[model samples]
Target chain A: MTTQASSTAIDAEAAGTVPRLSLNRWTFRTTPVQEFLEATTSRGIEAVGLWRQDVEEVGLDALRRRVDDAGLRVSSLCRGGFLTASAEADRAAALDDNRRAIDETAALGAPTLVMVVGGVDRADKDIVGARARVTEAITELAPYAEQRGVSLSLEPMHPMFAADRAVLSTIDQALDIAEASGSSAVGVVVDTYHVWWDPSLERAVQRAAASDRLLAYQVCDWNLPLAAEPLHSRGYMGDGFIDFPAITRMIAATGFTGDIEVEIFNENVWATPAEESARIIAERYQELVLPYA
Target chain B: MTTQASSTAIDAEAAGTVPRLSLNRWTFRTTPVQEFLEATTSRGIEAVGLWRQDVEEVGLDALRRRVDDAGLRVSSLCRGGFLTASAEADRAAALDDNRRAIDETAALGAPTLVMVVGGVDRADKDIVGARARVTEAITELAPYAEQRGVSLSLEPMHPMFAADRAVLSTIDQALDIAEASGSSAVGVVVDTYHVWWDPSLERAVQRAAASDRLLAYQVCDWNLPLAAEPLHSRGYMGDGFIDFPAITRMIAATGFTGDIEVEIFNENVWATPAEESARIIAERYQELVLPYA
Candidate 1:
């Protein structure tokens, strides 16, 4: 299956046609949405993964019209969930926000709403409990997401972010949450930058596929020094240590044909012009992912 | 088994005896070994994990005598292996140095020589190749180490260190090398700080125990950001996000009765007096690890 897809992708590239690629908004956070859309459309890249704040900034109605006019594909919305908080009010607010985010994602025609199941919120230090809370929040939100035709993709951020970002640090853990949610609407996002270091990653990806839980496959490289602050230091594809081809092959083996999204959170890259970064990302995607699509 | 051990530990501690703890040399790199040892002894800690460079500074012979005079136990030796260099000359030099380290570890009666199998030589992007080189290096050195009654403990660093520090980044990966080397002398060192983030860690620890592959069990916490440079910034147990007691319980469940060595590499902790650091580490271990033995 992967070979056939790769051949088709190669044929398309040879014919001077661009293959599918999703630009994660975090990569162009420095640029205004209007400028970003203009740049993306100019480059002939049609798909984008929008962040909630980005949508709010552009006004959802205006953003929707711009996306439609540009013929852009909404791959997946950038976020929802920090749902595992200590305060009941905060947790409830998060769920309400997520429900609205799901509605926004549906309005944008995004197939998936990415969720970062959050970290420990109390002094109790119960990671398992935090994970349980995440599972509960997802269960509560899944029916609404399904009704809105939006899949919820639980992105297990890197273990480095386990404290403040996402306690679900592995695909297996995310899949477990999906299973407990009792909704196929809830699935797992396989991000190379976050999970490439996992010894059981291949098996976990296969498990996600077998369980019909694979929602999104994001790509980026694991840079050295690992960065003192993980929020910003992601390496561009092929520029760091991760073997992108090997990892992408594993994701493909899972029968995951989801958009190969480029989600880099590098301060250096974000500071550059959105068009330049987008072009570089698209070009690298062509070089690294197209051949093995 | 863990419950029984914890009870025994509690009884021992209540009797006003000092806990058996080992100081990892990296924690005191800023201090002279003689001064560090003097401080540790003054504080009532009796065991030390020595670094090869520190041994060189004091002269191995003089160092051995100082340890003996101080009645200090050499728990383990800090390292031996950058065995993945691109050049054969460098690889051979690494092995030769490892051989010297084995001899020194034997002289000091340190039971295990920890190995940080070095990362990919920039010219070689093949992680599999680097791993193979590390395996061959271990195989070559295992017999010599066994003959000297010095076991080789392959310490799989955190995956964040996979690019530049050690290609062996999981306990399972380390166990594979030990199994292939076919030398009981070649085993794994399970460090909670590095492996706690691993979702498969519990299963890995159990497998390590079943295979009698555990050589040393080190304790520390996984701090956020993972430090762009992992040589420093390890969190003290109980101060960070890791479920230390749970991990210790998992290790103890394996029926492995190895010493639980405190191997923190935090800059803030190190800048303080070594005696104070050791006391704090001891206290944390008692609060965290001792609960699970």
Candidate 2:
């Protein structure tokens, strides 16, 4: 027993020697998946947050092989919700696809599968109804996700996206749904760029930690002039006004010891080489986040 | 007593006949104050929201006379805070100016004076401190406002303005300060363009109403392809996807039977004759808010 315990302690120590910081795939969406992986690996990043399209193009087997060969961890999968389909068939298909995504995340050895509960379809003016549908869909999908050994992370996007992207706009709102869903398997992603402006942020973070609903912490900066095309205009970390160290301290206060994922959706960053972006992010993680550790 | 009661009822009915819509002076920043008011009053607008600059240019007394002669209600005076100054002298100056503004609002018979608590001075990184300064300034000036019978409306602007404009970004946050200040004179202005995107909006509105913290309800639209300059790019009602009728219904649910002020700060609207702009907003308000009513 002592020998086994010592071996475990040594393994833990080895693991601690190399810190993990995740690079969200959207940061380099302009690059091919294989190239991105190769570049990121070259920069000594051991973890990645991937998108569905990237996996689809590379094929799951190829992705699995690449991740394994490069000794990389799949922190979280990019997306799988858009659950606001107008038709029953469409909604059913979206759910089925989400289940598949859960399977994929589990297959890739990722713990959390991200969900972006889609906005009201153009013809639908009932935002409340749309939100209800999102909650129901997640409730239904929770069992499947649990069965696959994957946690579902619902991302409440910025309020600007309430009409067309994701109806969930605040962490507290997301937590309400997560609590009502009655599943520890379903949780939420706390993205700084989307929620840094929320006045209830500290309270929400504490609540999320207390509920064990904080599945991931995604980092990015809030640009000075929020772009007309909000999806592509996210600022890179340290480039904009968000208090990152403060957020990290808040997250840590919750006893959350998880991967601090860098998620930028900047057009300028996306257009750059994946390796350069990964290196920049990794360097920032060390400079900004290391002190907290 | 019965005759007086009957007369009051008759006056209320007459006031109710004209839909309560006020043009925020910032909407016509480019136009001369006299021309703006003259055009708006001629277009049958019953109320106007004035700015300090507008009052200053036209001379507050002259503007007051013009409003009286035109039989227009000064729904709200545009602004009075900018209280987040670095130095004691600057802070004192802001408070003194706000006192003058309170006097002006009283002269114009404006029920509310809008307060946009300014952001941190560029060199300062203390937003929380700036907010503290704003609270202190407001507290100092609240007595003057109360004596003059002018309610000080704290306008919590959108989060995009957290750095350069108002630090208060949520209705709940504003209400907390309003309650803390121990002054009924200080309340909040609920602007649709700013607060519509808040996920906890309904609850915030209800809370504000319950506490009698709702001093004003301003209306405008959130346009997609958010204009090049967001500060002045608000859309007119029905032009954007904001659920106006639903929001108005929520506001009414709060038992806030206040003026539905039409405060659109749009470059498109402001560039035109103020009368045309006021007419357009009045028509939109009637079309959108009346249905909800």
Candidate 3:
């Protein structure tokens, strides 16, 4: 599958077409929905990824129409799954919530719904058990997501978050769950910040693309002198140790033509003006991400 | 091989012999060697693990004799390997230092020299290359360690430390290097704080034990709201979210009767008196670790 995509992508690139960037809402999470859209429009960015909370604050339909009117393509929705609860009632509630998230993704016309699989069960630190629960939950939801026309993109968060945030700690691990679902609606995400440290990522990205499961391409640098929270230590494209071009080349090698989403979660970044942040992010994407993408 | 160990350990346990705890120096890093010794001696703690810096500060020979006189056995030396240098001169220097470290371990009568194989190459973010360097360096040093009768135990640090600390981040990764050396002198350290999150740890521990490569067993909990240094956030046994009995059972299943080293690096733990800290750590280990061991 990737062979054709690779050749076609090369042919297209040689013909002068290039991939575009999708600015994730978490990059400027504090900005109001209207102002965030204005910032994207001002930067001439056609693609934007929205978080669940952001759409909720603005009323989903209102924000959806605003994005549609502004000609902004909804590349992906920020989140969905927290299906690791042990109790049947809690687990059922998680599935219900994810169903709504899927509905919202379709409502916003987003192509994908990114899922951060819940961490360990609260009463015990059984990571293996938690992962099993995640797989079970994704399997149950994949068909629903397929019916709703929004692919479920499972994200492998950094291993540091394995204990408290997401038990899915590697792209291969996420792919295992997605492939087990045996549905095209289930896919995997390649977030550079989460996966750059993986020794097997180069080959894993190739496998993901070959399987046609590479649903989203997310980029963010990982910084040193990590924040106390660890979550807020994600840096701007060029501000950290990640070799962007090398990793981007890995994705490109798989013939990925998806949005190269910039998804940073930094406290200092949140303090910047939305418009200025968008402009700077676009510039960084051009210089650091576009050439390879 | 694990089957043999399991049966033998079962027989031994049936005979009433059990594992013991070794208080790591970092568990009382701020205490004077004499005070640390006094605290351990008073508590009837028979084993301790010393850091390179601490040994260097007090003079290696003096400390060795002190441990002897105090009737305390050295379980394993704190660390040795930082052999991830790309340049020949730097790499050669690293080898020299590791040789000295082996000599120090032999001098101290410690059976194992714990190795934190250094991070990615300084000039590039090539973890793959750095990992290769670590293997090559370990291969070169294995014979020398055998001659010195000090087994080189490769420690797989948490993935979060991959960029700036150790390249070995999984027990299987360490075992690959250890087994490749084809020398009994090469082994692996199973530090719960580092390897607890690994999905394959249960199986990997079995492999390590079967190969007779389980040279040291270290314990420490991972706390949330990481310390400024990140490294200093290690909690006492029960303070963090790790399921101790489940993991400790993996080690015991391997029939590992070696010292169960308490290796916490928390700031608060360091602030207490060495005697008080020793008492608390021992208590936690008994409550959280002993039943499984």
Once superposed on the true structure, which residue ranges of model 2 sit more than 4 Å away at CA?
Answer: A1-18, B1-17, B85-90, B120-126, B273-275
Give a tens-digit lDDT track for model 3, residues A1-293. 13323443456446543347788999988888889888887776778999999777889989899999988889999899887888899999999999999999999999999999888775877778888999999999999999988899999988888878898888888889999988888989888888887777798888888889999999888888788779888888878767787888889888888787889899989999998888788767766777676
Q: Of the candidates numbered 2 and 3, which has the greater TM-score value? A: 3
Give a tens-digit lDDT track for model 1, residues B58-157: 8888999999998888889988878988688988899899999999899988999999899866664667778889999899999999999989999988
Better of 1 and 3 by lDDT: 3
- What fraction of the native interface does candidate 1 get right in terms of contacts? 0.43
Candidate 1: regions farther than 4 A off: A1-17, B1-16, B224-228
Candidate 2 per-residue lDDT over residues A1-293, each given as its tens digit? 12322342345335543265777878888887778888777776678898888778889988889889888889999788999877999999999899889989998999999999998666646677788888899899998988889999999887768778898888988898898888999888999888876777889999998999988998887776666676765777667766667777788789887777888887789777777787788766665554453
Candidate achieving higher lDDT, 1 or 2: 1
Q: How far in Å is the alpha carbon of B173 misplaced in model 3? A: 1.7
Interface DockQ of candidate 2: 0.45
Top-TM-score candidate index: 3
Q: TM-score for model 2?
A: 0.90
Candidate-wise lDDT, in order: 0.82, 0.79, 0.85
Interface RMSD of each: 2.6, 2.3, 1.5
- Residues A1-293 of candidate 1 have per-residue lDDT tens digits of 23534665777567654567788878888888878877777776768888889777878888889889988888999799898887789888999999999999999999999998888764776677787789899999999999999999999887767778888898888898899999989999988888876766888999999988898988888776555676665878978887777777788776676677888888789788987887898788877776665
Q: Can you rank all candidates by lDDT, best first?
A: 3, 1, 2
* Candidate 3 structure quality by residue, lDDT tens digits, B214-238: 8898999888867899888799987
Best by DockQ: 3
Q: For model 1, which pairs clash?
A: A225-B228
- The lDDT of model 1 is 0.82
